[model samples]
Target: MTAADGSRLYGSDASTADQREALLSGEVPVAVYGLGKMGLPLAAVYADVTGDVVGADVDEGVVEAVNAGECHVESEPGLSELVERTVAAGAFEATADPRAAAERAAIHVVIVPTPITDEKEADLSALESVARDVGAELDTGDAVFVECTVPPRTCADLLEPMLAEEAGHDAFGLAFCPERTASGRALADIRGAYPKVVGGVDDESTRVAELVYGELTDNDVLAVGDATTAECVKVFEGLYRDVNIALANELATFADEIGVDVNEAIETANTQPFCDLHDPGPGVGGHCIPYYPYFVINGFETEAPLLRTAREVNDSMPAFTVNTLAREVRAEGGDLADATVAILGLTYRPGVEETRATPAGPIAEELAAAGAEVVAVDPLLDDADEFVAEMIPQRALYDPDRDLDAVVLVTPHEAFDDIEWERFDPLVVVDGRQYLDLSDTDHRVYTVGSGVTSAGRAESAEPHRDANLAAEVER
Candidate 1:
């Protein structure tokens, strides 16, 4: 396709103006496979931009939900309205048949999950299945792009050959453009907020993919050398953040050992022009930060010592939080074996309901395994069952009138800022995320990485709970 400025956007032998004109004229459709969190919003954005969009997924419930103008994923905002408008405009529809979706579109986008196997290997089963489905309806000039986060060379070395074998073609136009959208801000990010990176098997394929994304966003579209480079870009971006977080956690631990205030140290350090450090937390979680680095190391068979060590350091944080809680319980003269430990926050991070790779999961499991009566609560999760089932939702957590030994703050949800500190009567509060201010509170508060102490009753200062001293302790 050629632009009005006489610049040829695609390679010389690529699809001509006829295809572009057909697309703009609502003749050439766009299809998106795997209508999950990323895929559904991407399909909605495309439907909003163009008049023809088809969404396909393996889950019939998801397809039906979208078709009925509803969103099953809580991360998406105003998704129901978008789906209703698109469906009413006759520009968007969802189905379970991948082949049908592929046949109806000239450009196909795959946003399926590339999860890791039990052995920590790159599991390409979902990507391979979608490629086979797309190949079944692959035409000579059809353009295909993978928007999923994958390991280096995954698109060029693994997916390309798979698509070729399935489609019975020697070559096809294909590219890899990793998604950089956040969970809550996906709609805006996908629309035009961030730059788009396009890398393809050939110049023609790169151009085709760039033109496709260019139509959606006005942001800068960069064309890298090949799919391998594009894939590495995303991995590096995520792994770098993970390593930095690990550093923050390690420093926080040292601050606790030295009886220094970590928050003050981090604040002072951040004032320097060259320093851009993140805060320490209970643990690293979320779909991207915790898992993306492993994909690179596992797929490429390279020794990423720092990256692997960073993952381990972050992963070990929950256990450390648990151990800290146990120690505090003992210091408070309370035996954790029979104490009721209330956990605040279950989602991975704040302000969103996605719980994939949430650190709270491991923290809760470890707390329960340690023989504590773990009563978990989060403003996002409605009930204990739902919290145990989905681990995240929009409803507030239930607060029962029961005495507690300690409360662990894992996620710093905004709503938690409003909670009354007096509710946990005489409870020890362990601020894992540093979400609380305990300066004025009479209760004992222990913060991770912040070695601050508070005045406690004599019974609490002992090594175990003394029922005799409880009568003397003021509520």
Candidate 2:
């Protein structure tokens, strides 16, 4: 894959014709660093598209898994087959050594994690480590693209100068094209459900990126003015959700007092063009939505009162959910201190194995702290020891002889459809997703953001009800 000068034929300065031929003919080596959930699918897609790709990661386990033609990220449709085909065909390989991958590939893609620190600062350690390694073996005219979501100005200000200082000689491409994909739908999203956003440090860098992703993706490639703008584009997308979800959660509390069904109302109101409100749940979970607000809240000097407040509102959801459950349970003569509470779902998103920043963790902690024996049910997780909660198989949750108190449906995973609420017949069933139809059942049920039903109020000793909820329900 080298020219007469022993350099990559597809370096930044090669003529358009030569670069195009090399990329299309599988002569130019393409490397995707960070063989993770997002990175693996991206690497597979790149290999399937270019017929030559390498995957690099710090974890030797991931490297071994990939090289053996085995996939570590499950539930992503078509990923296993893609990985098998790519590995067997010799178009893809995984390595623990970043320098080896960097030295071989002309097009380097970095998709490492950019976790936020406890102080809310962007922890660019992984990104920087990969950058340093890639720079040490830097070649002229190579292109390095970062798909990791980062704060604004990270690509140009921090990454560009760092790579330049390391390279010292030949030029390479540095761009931030944030990986905009969810866990289950990564392959489809990357192949082309959405257009690719590419913003490079310079005009030439942008042009080179446009050429690469344009050939790789079925969708059009958008070239932004610079890298920071591209970073803002991704951050803005996440910030919008954080704020919208906070608004929904806030309205949910008000709905209980006013006797309104926030979920029903949200669905009805969303029929219009400009009204797309997110669902109100126990809380916003997952790595992206909960933390992206910090980019503005902590990174910038601007007064972001609303952003801060929204985070507070979302963060309070787990405890709020617990309080709601506790109130109903106490009204039924069951104390959370001795109650056997079942947390229905553990993952942040349904059908996905990721539990990063999931609300279930906090909810379980609060319940256990209150002296409740919490048994979490999620088919995706073998054991939830990380959350310090006991794991119970979903089918076993329906054992006729088992005794339980309250049931909190957190994630609304599809497997919960078959649960017989009466089997665990004792206290209240709180639906955080608001989609469960427990109204027909004999058990008292409370849907978050909705007023307690007559069925729930009937469980009380008298006609007495929660004062705030009394106005919304009839006698």
Candidate 3:
């Protein structure tokens, strides 16, 4: 069969075996819109599986790079090699024109940005723009899949009607197949590190989605009730992390007052099958966790008190980290107002280059505002001109004559594991991630969710007796 003949699966009379065969051959062409980090990996995997796919991006540089057999996205394990192989084998190519790619494909997948506005409303501008392009050349039997996360009901309430209007008819299939992937492990996540979730506007859309992803992934395909449910699956996953991390952070704040190691307690409590608590950190960074809560809090009229409180708690952590540093400096007979502090690891995570809502920005700003001179060091990021603190290379950060009064371990990259703590004079150290083992050093240390250490000794903490032992002794 030619590329167009018997390739359409939306309303085809072909058998399931025949449809899968057609998709595996070069007959059923696929177009993936928005070739960003997640999008590129998705497109490459589609090309590898389907043998005919086009990646669409508005950025000319990205298109040129992909067309020339190069991957612009970094830190993904096998994406670079996959893109090169797919492009060289004629199984994949990229284009700046979405309309052209849509015209030749039986399936169009969109994974564009859905950023929030300044007022914290879900911005669907990029998604809508790509939807219009897909609709302009939309065929009757073609199917559209949305793999990006948005507020729930976006597919049913907004995208379906908009696509129908633009296409001048509603014969096409539409589904919400959210991208359940992470930045550093996109390929594994896409190719079935987890079960694929698919929901649709109608039965045919759901069937088509199940068929497509069933072939693409090695894991099982979960067909939900509708598109909104699939959207919620993605958003709710992030929201759960946000709330859990907030609880961990709130508990961490009580370590000093309660005189117990909250991190250790959390780790011990999680041994029970019923309990699963996340680690406490300086703040919730990364794009997914920080913004997903707002989708629920502001998307609907219903009040989300728990989500709002979680956001407030997580947002307050950066300031809390700074305050902890200031108090530690005072205990060390040094004033933050006359100190030069250094922030290590500016990115949200250790190895990834992304920094959408990283806590380092606020930490630096608060430290500088309190009259402390701040310098930041990150191995991944090349540009720090926008940071409130001076940007120093990682090599220069450990210079003996650097004149640093305090240090905060923010991201805890692997490069910091071998640092010689005795190279410099004693300074106040705040372990924001619970990553440092500086208890043996001369530096005074304060670990979040753990108590303080001074010159290889823990500060005096009030001890509590076990309830069972206390009752037995009193009897």
Candidate 4:
């Protein structure tokens, strides 16, 4: 397929209309690298639009599953069906060989992981490996889009030259069109939950990206100045959340000291439109928020006091949660060292199995160090082997023989809402996410940002006799 036949869109004299038609008609074959959580949905969407796409992954199992039209990634609403449909229609396929996919494809999209090292620096090894594979067989007029989140200057300084060197020429198009999709709603986000952002190393690259994504997404494609700007857009979005949550966590720490309910104050203050405070919880979990600040702070030589401070504040929250649990247990005439504490919901977010940088890990460690017997309840995970707690099903947590001195709700999973708070005897309950409403119960509830709510003594209250029996259990 030649440029004259409308097969190549980048660096071509073809009109925008012709380029759009070529992209949608599958004349400009697309190859997507990294078929993980974000990448699979992206490849499926590209296939759905272009009718010709190939996804490449290093994991043999992942490639095999995709080749069999099965999605290994879970919790994505419509990804499995999309993958099956695309593969069955011969519009999309998966391969273990990246070189084979790159050789025939005119458009390359890289959505590999850019995780942080233990030293808090951006780890682009995965991205670099994928880029080298794509670049090895990249044609003169081919287009490459980096949709993974990375440091601002990563594409402009690193990948651009790296890919050019591997390709032995600088005739290709390179752009950064970072994925703005979340975990559970990948299909909606990819199809058009938000406007797509596109920026290239040069003008032609930007134009090519705009044309391709314009058809892929229902929303507008925002063409920015350069690739670095697009990278900054994604990183800045996460940094804003990290810093904002840090501010909220700092304010929540003052709830008891200031003798006022900060949650109520924050909720009321946010009604003024200028204020957009995030909720303070046990800590900020999930892979994105906790690691994005480092992409800026460590990537540059400039001193970012605010970013560093935010990181410190957010990191301290897990320990603060454990300390609060200890203090509250003491107030209830029980020692944390001798108490049986149960941690509810181990996953970072409610229903997903993504535990990367989850606060539950640190919370469990702290509870163990303090000599508390920690038992975890999470239906999403089969076992708590990674955590320092005894893994127990949600139903077994309410057994009459098992007495819990305290409970910390690290993640406010919808499953936890069905918990029978009255089953347990009057105990210390630290609502880490402030999701519990134990005002009417005998248990003393201490919400993260709210002061302790007294639930009166059980002077004449009878023990819950049918706590285990005659009730429907759900997780």
Number of the candidate with higher lDDT, 2 or 3: 3
Which digits, one per residue and each the tens of the lDDT, describe model 3 over residues 177-217?
A: 99999899999999899999999999999999999999989
lDDT of each: 0.76, 0.81, 0.87, 0.85
Best by TM-score: 3
Per residue, candidate 2 scores C-alpha lDDT tens digits across 301-342 of 888999998988898888878877877787787888888888
Compose the digit string of candidate 4's lDDT tens values, residues 282-377: 888887999989998999999999999998889988887777777777767789999888888778998787887889888887888888887777
Q: Candidate 1 local accuracy as lDDT?
A: 0.76
Worst window of 10 by summed lDDT in candidate 3: 464-473
Clashing pairs in 1: 333-464, 333-465
Residue 315 error for model 1, in Å? 0.8
lDDT, model 2, position 90: 88
**Better-scoring candidate (lDDT), 1 or 4:** 4
Q: How many backbone clashes does candidate 2 have?
A: 1
Instruction: Give model 3's TM-score versus the native structure.
Output: 0.94
* lDDT sort, best first: 3, 4, 2, 1
Name the candidate that leads on lDDT: 3
Quote the lDDT for 272 in model 1: 98
Question: What's the lDDT of the predicted structure labeled candidate 2?
Answer: 0.81
Q: How far is 82's C-alpha from truth in model 4 (Å)?
A: 0.8
Candidate 4 residue pairs in backbone clash = none
After superposing all C-alphas onto the true structure, candidate 1 shows an RMSD in angstroms of 6.1
